[model samples]
Target: MKSYRIIKSPTEGFYKEKGSKFLGFAYHVNSLEDVKNKIELLKKEYYDARHHCYAHLINDGNQKLIRANDDGEPNHSAGDPILGQIRSFDLTNTLVVVVRYFGGTKLGVSGLIHAYKTAAEDALSKAEIEVIQIKQSFVVEYGYEKTNDVLRIINDFGVEINNQEFLAACTLFGRIEPEKYEALKDKLNLVHVKVSKT
Candidate 1:
């Protein structure tokens, strides 16, 4: 299994050019909803800012989802530059937003790009990078008679149990590398454990 890098926590960065101020925020996001919520909060906090541009990259199954928004800035000026910083850092499941407070100055396209890029770069540079394995979650259910056998198979296959119930019918919520899932499923099926990906 391959590992990917992401920020451990949210971070902020700043840049000022030609009297205009740029505030940057970087976050480790899990889904599209997370990105939208963060942007909404920032918009409310920086209500008077002239623009709120953003970019995000998400790992969804075998595909990488990416989006960038200029928020009325000249096309490709703000958003793409911010996304470029994300790409340079080789990070996934991350979102970067840059808010601009225009200070009666019109930063030409080049200037805007530099400002956004620098702000995003600063934010990412301040983040604590973390590496994580790609994992898939699954649920396993089995009768009490096969509880030990099912649990042993999961344990031997390196599945991390996140939750469990020890009732008459056993249930376990676990996560493991996707590559090992098929093998694990086969082993569990032998003992009549019902397994399904979550």
Candidate 2:
């Protein structure tokens, strides 16, 4: 199985039709439940909007699932297009909501589709995406004198420090990238340090 990182921040866009306002919102979420919660929050925030259509794609490394709602748009005009945009980007753990204010002028079926697609694209463009990895944890210990050097080396190596605790003479913490265990051991050994798998 393969894993990838999700978007780092929420994205939003606003568009207008005739005299009506539409707001498109996108969020990178971790789970289906989180997506639902976000949608509810948006609904509350924009209580007067005429419609709140939404879609989401949830990926758990091995499999992916999609869910969406049209709110009150004409059948497939709103939700499906938003969902298609998510799929087109190969994105996961993401949800998008397009809020329409009726605009007084009804955008025909084709116009509505275009509007929804453009809204999704605009929101996606503002998002910052990142890649994340699942890794094991380890604890490395060293004398006080070597602490600074170890910290620098860990930072330079791009390893994540999960937690750190201090004892009388040394620092202990958890780290990731199990494959780098041997390499880290070598670096510590050169500095007269020791590592314990946690």
**Which structure among the candidates has the greatest TM-score?**
1
Tens digits of per-residue lDDT for model 2, 1-198: 234646789999777767767789989987878987998898899999888998889876567868878887888998999999887776778998998888788888888888887788788778888876666577777777788888877786677777776665676676667677788778877878778776
Give Cα distance to truth, residue 90, candidate 2, Å: 2.5
TM-score, candidate 1, is: 0.81
For residue 87, what is the lDDT in candidate 1? 89
Q: In order, how many clashes per candidate?
A: 0, 1
Error of 1 at 5 (Å): 3.4
| Candidate 1 residue lDDT tens string, 1-198 | 378999999999999998899999999998999999999999999999999999999996668889999999999999999999998999999999999999898999999999999999999999999999878899998888888798779879988899999889888999999889999999888887899999
Backbone clash total for model 1 is 0
Which candidate comes out best when scored by lDDT?
Answer: 1
Q: Give the poorly placed runs of model 2, Cα more than 4 Å off.
A: 134-198
TM-score per prediction, in order, is 0.81, 0.67
